[model samples]
Target chain A: MENNRGNKYSIRQRILSSKLTFTILSIIMGLLVGAIVLLIAGFNPVQAYRIMIDGVFSRTKYISYAIIYATPLIITGLSVTFAFRTGLFNIGAEGQYIIGALVATLIGYFLELPLVIHVIVVFLFAAIAAGLWGGIAGFLKAKFGVHEVIATIMLNWIALYLNNYLVMRPFLRRPESESSYDILDSASITILEKWKYSETGREWLSAHPYIKDFLSAPANLGFIIAILLAILVWYILNRTTLGYELRAVGFNKDAAEYGGIKVEKSIITSMMIAGALAGSAGALQVMGVTKNVIMLPVMEGYGFDGIAVALIGGTTAIGNIFSGLLFGALQYGGPKIQPPLGAPSEVVDIMIGTIVLFIAIPKLFKIIMNARKRGEKNAK
Target chain B: MLNDIGFIIGTSLMYAAPLLFTALGGVISENSGVVNIGLEGMMTIGAFIGAAVGYYVGNPWIAFIAAGLAGGIFALLHAIASVTFHADQVVSGIAINFLGPGVALFISRLLFNGSTMTKSLSFSAKMPRPLNGLFRSNSFSDIIFNQYATVYLAFILVFVMWYTLYKTKLGLRIRAVGEHPASADTLGVSVTKIRYFGVILSGILAGFGGAAMSIAVVSNFRPTLISGQGFIALAAVIFGKWKPQGAMWACLLFGAAQGLTVYLGGAGVINISSQLLAMLPYVLTLVVLVGFVGKSVAPAASGEAYEKGE
Candidate 1:
């Protein structure tokens, strides 16, 4: 019995110390904090949370919307995660994203080509533009010893204004609207978009109410692309020699240099790839949902959200998909609580913040474990 | 023509004041070896608190102080996570950034009857213009001198900070702790305490910067009000090479660029688009960083968690 009890205690300690365990605990703690905040603000926490959950899962359409939101987040999260794995903090994902969207919008509006080729060209140009945007920071960091953080932050602002300037131009701006003109039909990536609107297809969808509802959303191939990209990133990081070199550089730059890895080229390449990922997110967003670029007074925070997703996901490719979905669900459902429960949508922000905060201090778990061990020792 | 120049200078001072306060905060916190990217969040919280309190209490001074206190409270979280728990400073800072704005907006909506923006303060409730009646309206002197009280406070604090950093023993200890906490520990200085002080102080000053914008520059707190000023101040801290006076100059330069944008937009003397003009400060900072400021080294022990006996 004594041996069994000791074994149980050790097992509990081991489980408690695991990263997955910590992540789950942190998420729970975050929800608890959100509940407390809701309670203090004179709202029913249980009811609010129920509404939020219902908002995401109540309808097939809602689930599609959630997925739609998750698509960009997953791509951007992968962008940040890739840069992080290479030991570079790519805060300029926001800038790269903006550049991608801008380039994609320009291409999608101007270019008239065959269907498959049109979409491919749009993605290619957008990715290249954003990759070059990110590469500028890498170049600055490599050659001039400028910090990536500052360079990226500045670049984010420049990108924001550049987007605004381009969108406002007479050639791009939609008449009587704050956004750019919609992309050509060929450039759109929405799944079954034309078919769903067609008479025969509408009749078919009407017979299947769930499919009809799902089709009502701007659901596109972005999610599939995101999944494929995540798997590709995973394979690259785990398999390729380039990935090995980048990981080595990330682990220790001095050691990587001593080991004869070209650190400068690696940094530049990592940033470019990261930029391309973020750029792809923007391109997909334009092609799938908005279909046009809207001038924003402030950052829309897809990139910042990516940072949170990457952090929560443990900077893993697969982990980002899950965390991105979680974030997307929260973002989609957060507004629902505001309308019905009279709770603020910012509650979602608080929950996300709390989760990130708890994750940051892993020592809290260690402290608890140490105390528990001491308690056991004292009881014995 | 003189009026336009005066107006531009006034606008520059108005813009510079908020950044100056925040940059000073950055200098102090960074001097103590903490990288505070969350200054933006602290400023956001401060902006909201200042506006909300000013609207309700009808007293700008009280609102400003409240904003600072709110910021300090938030900074305590950063200090706890980074200084005590040995958490990643950047990660902790990012969390604080999210929390600060998140809590601010959540409470702002709760208080303002579901609106993200706070109610605007009356002119009397806003930050008082100190030299308002001293000079003729629209005169160059009036435009330059008849500025918000926070503007003067920001300038004064710069000198005060410069003196403290260069002259005082406390400043020396803060610097010593940042430069080499292990050595500071050997000398019986509490590294943890000093860092906490530095971070919290930074938060308070950042809060003041936010309040300066909300209560003085404009009239109310909106979602976009403190958008990138915190970040610009951060750039100023870097551009200034981590010196208090240097940061002041950097803020002034950025502020002047802002003034130029505002002046050119309002005056329409130049047909430049406002959006393109708005990119001036950020672009200039990047150029300055690349061309002039080669490698601005941070404090020796900055961003590293100090472990005892390690």
Candidate 2:
């Protein structure tokens, strides 16, 4: 069924094939696997899929909320993808996320500035803080020759405890409250009551009444920024010289070095950008959703999740968007799976783990390729 | 202050115990060329199985053996995946990490009700009050000396492992295989067999380490409690330069850092936020790892899977 004769292709198409096919396949594969998982759990796969679809596309509010949920994942996923593209594994996204949020939280709490400036300051400071946090691993890797994987994992612990310490110390939250001081209305993304309801369908089942009152992905305008950033990332990767050098380094360090690329510099820069992306995610989450940085009990574990996102996305920019959305859906749908079947929230995590396992098993793809080759030969 | 110093050292020593076992586990596996990233999970599993067996069988010794056996079995899975099937060592290690927690969570859930957390034993699972009225008039001796049996075992394991690795023939082959499997293969050593033994030994050590946490330190099993100690074990593995004695010191030092965090958190000794103090051990790993990256060479082929035919 393959057309060998129509082999002529432009340079753009080759790049597109490497990026697009994987993105499409990952999205489709994640969904299909997710569906199978749901089916095995005794839920109708179709119904579960419909619930997720309805959750996202069923209303304007849902879509906004879905976009909101996707905000940090998109940002964090991009952060991860950026590093992967540069051949660095920044598994400390969680740490960077926390440090970013902590910076923003500290800023948002003390500052009484006007809304726009307040949000901008919070996000910027957070990004800088997180970038520096990630830069440590990069710095260590470059200077000391330590593996980023080991160092970043260590960093995750430091972040977890560091955030916990913040929650307990100077930022010691009130006894009844487990969070930081709430930000002023300027920093918060309170959904406008006017836009709360579904514009298309005002009916009871058509719109969720709780959608207006509930928490969001990244509450504020950060989701919009994250989406716009993805487009920019696409441009950078496909249209910039820096992107080419970074990618060449990622594809083969020896070859890239031979090709006159400063591989080490590229790695450090990539890690900084990756950290910045994750930090932005933290900023968005703190400003948009939480309004202030509320120290949670544990590090959000999003960075660890981001690894899976980057991997399944083939570590590409645009591909990360779809794969991230897929991951986001699984994460969002995870809570929905509870209560009915009495499964723990960790079941979703277990499934995510399994999906990572399935993905890592490259033999499945090898077998598929072999079968296709055999078919082609038999046809000949 | 003397009591505090004594307390800190004592708790640090106590914390060092599990970490020592874990690092030894790291040493065992890495010495054979497999990096056991699942040590934390393996430890968790060990804790559960140890607790369950110890609790039911009424014999803590049985718990230790059962835990080691269970850990050996888990190692077998890694052995097959990495050695025979030729999976990426990191990938397989990660898979075991994922699988261990899930299986533990699932099986724990099946056995317990009302909470996802495993129920605490009727008594401390493996911890026994030391001194046994040897100094009924002395609170100091009881408080300082009394701790779990596992804690003592972990310390003993440090020397045991060092002796086992450096002063033994089997350890030589294990080290040789880990360093250069191809060269070792030509020397007529069963490269695969040694690697399998190395990884399995690691699982057992890690399993015992996990048991220590559940039994000696926490006295219970819970999600997120191990809190990346597996990596700490890894750091100890590196910080010790992959040597048992050095790793034990690192583990004790890191463990003390942990004990200090808790002590200071409890006493408010440092104005440093408890969260910041909590970050100490992990942050310190970086500080430690950076202290000697190139100087401390790993087993030459630590993360690389050894393929026989290749």
lDDT of 2: 0.72
The Cα RMSD across the true interface for model 2 is 3.0
What lDDT is obtained when candidate 1 is compared to the true structure?
0.91
Top of the candidates by lDDT: 1
- What are the lDDT figures for the candidates, one per model? 0.91, 0.72
lDDT of 1 by residue, A1-380 (tens): 88877674567667888887878888998899999999999999999999999999999999999999999999999999999999998888888999999999999999999998999999999999999999998888887777888888899999999999999999999988889999999999999889999999999999999999998999999999999999989988889999999999999999999999999998999889999999999999999999999998899888888988899998999999999999999999888999887799998988998898888889988898799889999999
Residue B277 displacement (Å), model 1 = 1.7
Interface RMSD of each: 1.2, 3.0
Candidate 1 docking category?
A: medium
**Worst-scoring 10-residue span by lDDT in model 2 chain A:** A210-219
TM-scores, in order shown?
0.97, 0.84
CAPRI class of candidate 2: acceptable
Error of 2 at B53 (Å): 4.5
